[model samples]
Target chain A: MSPFLRATLTIAAKDLRSEFRTKEAFNASLSFSVVILVLFSFAFDPTSEQMQAISGGLLWLVFSFASALSLNRSFARELQNDCLDALVSAPIPVAAIFLGKALANYFLLILVEITALAVFALFYDTHFAAQLWPILLVIALGTWGMTVIGTTFSALTVNLRMREVMLPTLVYPMLVPALMAAMTLTTDLMNGIPLGGDNLLWLRVLTGFDFIYTLLAMVFIDIVVVG
Target chain B: MRDRIMYVLATLSAALLTWNLYKIFMILPDEKNQGAIYRIVYMHVPSIFTGFTGFFVALAASALYLITKDLKYDAFAAAVTEVSLAFASIVLATGMIWGRIIWGIWWAWDARLTTMLVCWLIYFGYVMLRRAIDEPTQRARLSAVVSVFGCVDIMIVYKSIEWWRTQHPAPVLSVRDGGGMGPGMESPIYWNWLAFMCLASILVMVRMRQESISREIDSLRRMAHAY
Candidate 1:
């Protein structure tokens, strides 16, 4: 592998190992999502037909909150013992640091999202046995879209005061378009609506959002880190 | 000289604004379908135009700040974004009034409206982000990057919302789509936009001046070890 790719993968692996040992963020995000999902059931009859149609929106909403929960701390971990200063001074490109964190967050979020979705399904009793692959594809695109924005903004707000508040405020607004596309696709697929028609456009939109933002974030990460 | 220019621009904006209101309320004929309620479009379109222009300028200024490592561009971006929020608020309010009457609702989650709203939220957070960081270079660098993220999100939001619905009228100005309105009908909106643009420019300059002075004070305080 090229040095850039190697550095990126190394950073990703390091984050994964540290996070796996603690699972602090993982447990927090998952339990928060479960609480939110359970709380939502009280607000509406999850067994009703209406819930089946709108559960896609609800599921992603839970995941968005879950995303905010974990991303806020993604960089805070490096702040301990001035690890961030050391990392920035490292020989690796800052973009690698960013991509590494983003990739790690992507993997963590997808795990959280799948778990959350299963919880949502169990609560709402919705099924998508026939469209599993496409649902996973949409989840990847949509989660990647949010992951790019959330990861970048996490770094942006990591040093700011009240960053726990600032991260969500900064991250959620950008997530709207992505969340909307994700919700729409998930709902349609869960309803047995196939892709490759009007749905094709939404798929393109979600993918395009992921592609452009990832590229933009990589190009701009150095500026954010002040490297 | 600067004060003179400010004086001239402010007066011109006030005079043109009065004239545009006069033209909209008295000179222009009522719409065939909606009557006088449609007159709200005059304010709605111009406010959004000025706001969007400010936002676009912010994007440019932010990019320049990134490339040059200059704090002035950061100040300019901050000024433009705050001024743009004022205009965006006007657009939302006027749009609400217009939609209530013409579309029989106070708000519609159409493409244009959704983008305008989401754009406003993102930039508002940009301003907040500026407040949370105190170091000069760090603030400038981070907020500029966030501004780029905001601009990119605007396009994504617009595109994603387009997939759902698009109820806002097509571009009616002669500059766009070859003029959706009749020849004479479009001129007032353009006139109003020019007026508002001048007004927004004044706000931006004043804010920039404040920013520079405040930054100077911040550095002096740091030199004195204030905190």
Candidate 2:
């Protein structure tokens, strides 16, 4: 494997190992997503016709909020012992470090999204299994999009005074188009809309967004991380 | 010489905007379909035009700062972003007024309006990010990263109408698709675009001066602490 890929995997493994062992942020974000899923039913009648139409929006909203909650912790742990500075000064490439952490974030967020989807299915009686491949496709694309921007901005605001507040404030707006695409696609999937033809446009948009942002984040991550 | 140019830009924009206002209100007649409500286009279109211009400029300035490691470019980027945010606010306010009158709604979740608002929020978050960081180099580096990252939305905002073509009108300014205005009515929008640019230049100049002074103060405090 290329050194860059190796470095990224190593960092991602380190993060996943540490996170899985303690499950501090993982458990918090998972619970956050599940709780929001349950609370959403109270916010609106989940059995209503309108609720069926908007279930996708509600699910993605929970995923985004919970992901932002966890992404902020990606770098917060490094700050514990001035570990961020030490990591930056190490011999590994800066972009690799960003990718590794983003990869780890992607995995954690995916797990949260899957659990959230299961709870949503159980509560709302939505039939996602019939469109399992399409739904998973949307989730994978959308979650990667959110994880990329979230991880980069997590590093961006990690050194700030009000990072707890700043991270979501910054991440949420940037998350819109990706999250919107995700929400729209998810809604259509839940409502039994076909995934190709005219829907091809949204798929293109989601894919394009994921590609462009990942490249931009990688190019700029060095300045944010190493500076 | 710089001061002279500022004066010239300020005087020209003020005069042109006055003439433009009169022309829009007095010279131009109401549209057959929308009547007086359409006049808000003069403000709404130009404000968003200038706002987009400022965002791209900030993007470039941020890229330049990253390449040169120059504090001046960072400050320039910050000033342009903040001033452009003011222009973006005008766009939202005027667009809402026009929408309320023409479409009978204050806002719509249509692609264009929502993406425009997303751009506004992203940049506002940019300003908030800058305020949270105290270290000069770190602030410059990190915020420049974000300035570039946030600009990805501007592209999405620009294409949203073409992409979704829902409630928002198509490219009226460019005569694309079935979406052009009466031949001469659009002249005012183009001229006002220039006027808003001049206005933005004046504000950016004033803001950049403040940014420079703040940088100096920041350095002085650092020096004092060192001593």
Return the TM-score for each candidate structure. Answer: 0.95, 0.95
Cα shift from native, residue B129, model 1 (Å): 0.6
Candidate 1: tens digits of C-alpha lDDT, residues B140-164? 8888888888888776644544465
DockQ value for model 2? 0.87
Q: Write the per-residue lDDT of candidate 2 for residues B22-114, one digit (tens) a residue.
A: 999889998989988888899988888898899999999988998998888988999999999999999999989888888889998788888
Per-prediction DockQ: 0.78, 0.87
Proportion of the native interface contacts kept in model 2: 0.97
lDDT of 1 by residue, A26-81 (tens): 99999999999989989988778998789789888898889888888888889999
TM-scores for chain B, listed for all candidates: 0.91, 0.94
- How accurate locally, in lDDT, is each candidate? 0.86, 0.88
RMSD of candidate 2 to the true fold?
1.8
User: Which lDDT tens digits does candidate 2 get at residues A23-124?
Assistant: 998899989888888888788788889987898898888888888778988988899889998889879999999999999999999988898888889988
